[model samples]
Target: MFDVNARIGHWPYRPVGTVDDLLKNMDALGISCACVSSLDAIHFLNPQDGNDSLARAIAPHRDRLVPLAVVRPEFAGWQDDLTRCLESHGMRGVVLYPNYHLYDLDDPEATELGARCSEAQIPVFVQVGLEDARRQFGRTIVPDVSLESVGAFGREHPSLKLVALGLKFGQPDQLRQPLPKNFYFDTSNYERLGDLEFAVSHFGVDRILFGTCAPLFHPRANADKLRCADLTAEQREAIGQGNARALFGL
Candidate 1:
């Protein structure tokens, strides 16, 4: 399986463990590859530092772990950081946290980043929410990224590959249709019994990717969700890894 949403590094509220632990969890779950981003990057003053750390940590395990740079386009020199991540560090794609970064999706910087990623032909993973709203710390509450903004951004850059991670069960229905062909969603945070089946029917099998949201949520939970979903063998394979392989050119 190719996990499209996974993270390494610290989470303030809990111990997220190390890369070795993640690899072990993946091994147990039969997940061959995972697109991992830095949890530290979300709140970093210079997010590139987190990207750099991730690049180094994943360098030795490039065969199994695909690094995704966490980029905050609002920061100065972000262009240089992105260029280096793609060209120098060999990151497969980027993950954006608009809510934590405190930037609107329609801002010039965000637009420029989307355009650039489109031009580069790399997928951009947009995190909808890191934690459940009710569970968020009152002292450091970060609202979820607006689904409207996500849909609007995808419409603006129809050529870009946009993956929305951590979307709740009912959230996809809120996006205006017809949904962009290039836009996709992961299987993380969909806890309802029929969520996977609903996603397959609503978003199409090709648009759904297997994601564990690991270290924050157990890898087995989502894997079991996929296992129990009412899908054909082909549809199951597509979501498990085939879709991600096609999207990321793996």
Candidate 2:
């Protein structure tokens, strides 16, 4: 699951023991591969430091997990830092924390960062919402990362792929028609308020990927949702694993 919302200190997280521990857990959950980020970054301080912690934790077992670097694109020299990350760490996908970073998604820096990521062929993971924020104790005035900004960036660069991590229902239909060929979405948080049937029907199974936000949420819930749904075997497979493989070129 390439979800952007998982954290290190969440109540439901299973402590990661080793790379083997993570892999074995994924196997037990029927997940072959995932792009993981640090929970500390999503909940604690700056995302870059959290990313560093995650990198240190998973560096040895990179074979099992694909690290999606969490970055605040607004910070100075972030592009250089990102280039170094892609070069040294072999990171392919980047997760943006627009809410925690406290910047408008339409900011010029964010726009440039998207283009830079596009040039690097690195996909972006953005969150539409993280439902547990207020319940977990945090400040107010958190600016949401508007989909319109992501759409504007996508429109500007047709080749860049953008994935919305936790989109909710009635969240506006930007992806309704003439859908951006480059933008994709996940089915992790679809348990409530998501149009799963419509996504499969309109976006096609290939365009939607499966993500369970593991530890924070059980993979079984999502897997069961896909299983019980009225879809063809091929469609289910695409949503469960095939789309992920294609997205990551795995």
* The candidate that achieves the highest TM-score relative to the unseen native structure: 1
The deviation in Å at residue 105 for candidate 1 is 0.9
Report the error of model 1 at residue 132, Å.
0.8
**TM-score of predicted structure 2:** 0.84
Please give, for residues 51-132, the per-residue lDDT of candidate 1 as tens digits.
9998888888999998899999899999999999999998889899999999988999999999999999999999998798
Model 2 scores worst on lDDT over the 10 consecutive residues at 3-12
| Model 1, runs deviating above 4 Å | none
For residue 80, give model 1's deviation from the true position in Å.
0.3
Q: List the residue pairs that clash in candidate 2.
A: 7-39, 8-39
lDDT of 1 at 189: 88
**True-structure lDDT of candidate 2:** 0.68
